[model samples]
Target: MLADVQKALDAFGEREINRVFFVGCGGSSSIMYASKYVMDRESTSLASDLYSSNEFIHRNPRQLGPESLVILCSHYGKTPETVEAASFAREKGALTVSLTFDPDAPLAKASEYVIIYEDGKQGGTFANEAPAIMLELVLGLLSSKEGNTKLDELLPSLENLRGIIDGEKAKSLAAAKAFAEAYQDDKVIYTMGSGANYGIAYWFSICLLMEMQWIHSHALHAGEYFHGPFEILDEQVPVIQLVGLDETRPLEERSLEFTQRYGKRIIVIDAKEFDLEGVAPSLRGYLAPLVMQAVLRQYAEELATARNHPLTTRRYMWKVAY
Candidate 1:
């Protein structure tokens, strides 16, 4: 998939792609946030924007133009809003690329280029595939212009990610059991993370806890915790902190310390505990969110099991018209 994405990027060689848009919905949109975070930290010239599928179709940013590269993601490749956004971008003459599990789905057909992965083949998480492919393509494209050596070094680490993630399943599942038991009775929960992990926190809160389990959850950036969110922290409120190995670790640490002081039920899932074997040390920080996502998939499953609620038991998602 990476090789195919590389070829697609290569085909855009001589064009002046001034901006890049990562457009999707829900978990897919969170994946875009991870890619945008990487692009902001690594790319010197290209500007990256993240937009939800419906928002992209409705607001249509002025920066999206003929010289823009728009990448969209949909797990089943049939998200209506995302497919429409792809068609809209293509109609506007922007290059459209899609990452999905189904190559023949609407999103893939609407895109000029598509990277398809077999869902559930690698543990049923797009977290590993989408982020890695998009990061590689974005960095690979930027490397040609910025000459960043980190891109070259970092690209190789992706080769061993599957093995490392697979190896951590036991540990992740164990942690998940503990987490699910702790919060099974709770009606609401709050989650916090900084930097790239913020998107992971958001994804887990909205997609898993809220949408799947029918629990109320809020995801807050660690840096913004003290401003207003901290007031809600109490002995009874459950707070889950996702700590990553990035520069923003200290921010999450601060939030963790405060949560520990004020909140009795504090669950900390630190990516630092995972040994990302064969992954480059320098790139681990950037890849921490993807690692955490893989780990949290175990948590989501355990939580659903403990609560006796199947993750697919949605009240309104697909049962009725929204």
Candidate 2:
């Protein structure tokens, strides 16, 4: 999967892409989400721009013209929603691309182009790690190409990031820190963010809810926090803010200060500059989330296990009304 992602990345070199839409169900959508986070300002993405196939007939009807390229992602080719989306796009004359672990699934046959992700493993539940890493690789390639970064030069740092993420000891340390902050006496977790980090906030809620601690969680925009979310803040319900070096730094800083002003506590993840309190500065953009994934994964798994839950499950998700 990693090498394939690298190949897709290597193949992307600002190849005159005007518009691309990414469609998927559940975590498969992360490809588009991560892509949008790393997307160049010069280009536009419809990646996170998802729509339910059943609803399309009434709301937000897709006008798929011949010139559009639609990227379809599904870990399992059987996801009815995604497959229907692909079929709809294809019938409307859009190009389709699919990335899936199962090469023989319906999605593989449905897509015009397919990238197989068989990591020498048999059937198992799809975790958050592999899909995120795989999508990141391809989008990183596409992004680097668009940003005009020498691919060879960026490869080393990207490799370094991969190494740190893959290393158990480093992941352990980061996870320990995140657990202390995430599961500290508070049962309520408030996720707030701005800019690209907003997606991280969204992803955090997903992991925390679905995989990790099954605690009550809510996510909101950092600026909007002052309007209403701030009222709910207290020591027992501390705010977990995503602060990265994106365009939202100044506002995040103000948000950090605002949290402290009300005696509302916070644990900053991926923010810049610490002159103020709760400003956890991480690397810029996608790199920040990559760097923080270790801790996030750790806290999520540990909390889930501590509550006697398995890290992966299939019982509930298979209720597909096919």
Q: Which stretches of candidate 2 lie over 4 Å from their true place?
A: 1-17, 44-63, 118-147, 150-154, 166-187, 210-212, 263-265, 271-283, 313-315, 319-322
- On TM-score, the candidate that comes out on top is 1
Model 1: residues >4 Å from true position, as ranges? Answer: 120-128
Give a tens-digit lDDT track for model 2, residues 1-322.
Answer: 3555555554443233344666775556643554555544323443334443444423534555555556677777777767777777777766666678787888878876667764324523222234444445444544653553433333444445444444533535554555665564556777777766665676677655543555577767888777887787655666766676666667677787877676445766653321211112222454555445444556666656555666565345555444
- As for model 2, its CA RMSD to the true structure in angstroms is 5.9
Where's the lowest-lDDT run of ten residues in candidate 1?
Answer: 119-128
Question: Local distance difference test, per candidate?
Answer: 0.84, 0.56
TM-score of each model, paired residue for residue = 0.95, 0.73
lDDT of 1 at 226: 89
In the range 46-84, model 1's lDDT, one tens digit per residue, is: 888888989988898987889999999999998899999
Clashing pairs in 1: none
Q: Candidate 1 has what TM-score?
A: 0.95
